[model samples]
Target: MRWKHPVLGEFSNETLIHMAEQNGLIFEVGHFVLHQALKAANDWLAVCPTFCIAINVSSVQLKNSGFVEQIRDLLALYRFPAHQLELEITESGLIVDEPTASDILNRLHILGVTLSLDDFGTGYASFQYLKKFPFDGIKIDKSFMEQIEHSESDQEIVRSMLHVAKKLNLNVVVEGIESTQQEQFILEQGCDVGQGFLYGKPMPSEVFTLKLESHAQA
Candidate 1:
């Protein structure tokens, strides 16, 4: 989310999201984000059956009693495929109300929506989260990639993470993959998916759609 500030111009919503959390407004904000994301994906990628859209989910939104139903209703309303919509939840987000979060996640899984544990390895109880939650995959945090080329410890850490994820049968996606060396290293480590500046920076929806169309034609 981005905010248009009168003094600071446009900025990302990190501060705004903190405020929303403090004010008990994150639930509404989270739902709005999900709704808009699903709507946009449905509108732009309706014909692209292989495309999957991932949305970050918050703890406050997860604990809400109606969260799962909201997702179901939205998918039906948009006529979007449940399996093509991935909800990325952070370890910190799942820390609060574990039982509730687990229940909600289970329900979402039942609906055929993919669930990914986002920013893996940064949180305090990352391993515990893996044991508790029913996650289909994990996105390794970018911190591990920063010094992966030179640091043996970082390399071991990533290898360990990949090993654990593999043992759990979870798909692993490495983040912050900029240089070819970094990409090659993760690829060698058996990470099949990655996202970073190396591939492409963030772009508008129209530009993304055009790229997809071009790729389809190619």
Candidate 2:
């Protein structure tokens, strides 16, 4: 999500998120992003109905008092299947409001939308989160993948993550697989899904649809 800045020339998604936080409206912005994801998901599913969409949920969005209702309303508005949607929430975000988070997460789970812990290894008390929250998958942070090929320690770290996800009956997605070697290594270690420039750079919905269509045809 890079954007041309009047002064900075360009800003990345992280910078945008950071800027949003400064304004203290990140929660509101997150809600808008979620709805946009739903719209895109609805678009893709219309063409390739088997497609499953994953959207990140910021902690602020999760902690909002009316989040659950907003989600319910959006799901109804989009007519998107709950089973086809997966929400990825960060570990740091969940600690802000445990009881509320738990209740809302449970409700989302009951709604049949899959949940995942994104950037799994970068936050506090990660292992405990797997036990406390109900998630169907764990997204291995790109930092681990960046070193998985060159660093023996990283290989071991990824292996351990896979083992934990396996034991918990959760799926594993390794992001940032920019090379064939990276893809092979993660697959060999039992990772079930992956995403990176090795596949394609991120693009607008129309471009993504074209790529997906070609992939489907292939």
lDDT of 1 at 207: 82
- The list of candidate 2 runs beyond 4 A from truth reads 1-10
lDDT (Cα, tens digit) per residue for candidate 2, span 1-218: 45677987877666776777779988777777778888888888867888888877776777777887888888898989888888888876798888888888989999888999999888768899899988888999999888777899999988998999999999889888899999999889877589889988757778888988888888
Residue 152 lDDT (model 1): 100
Best by lDDT: 1
TM-score per prediction, in order, is 0.93, 0.92
Candidate 1 lDDT by residue in tens digits, 16-109: 6677889999988888888888888987665477788988787788888899999999999999999899998987678778889999999999
Off by over 4 Å in 1: 4-6, 13-16
Q: Model 2, residue 185: displacement in angstroms?
A: 0.7
Summed over model 2, clashes come to: 0
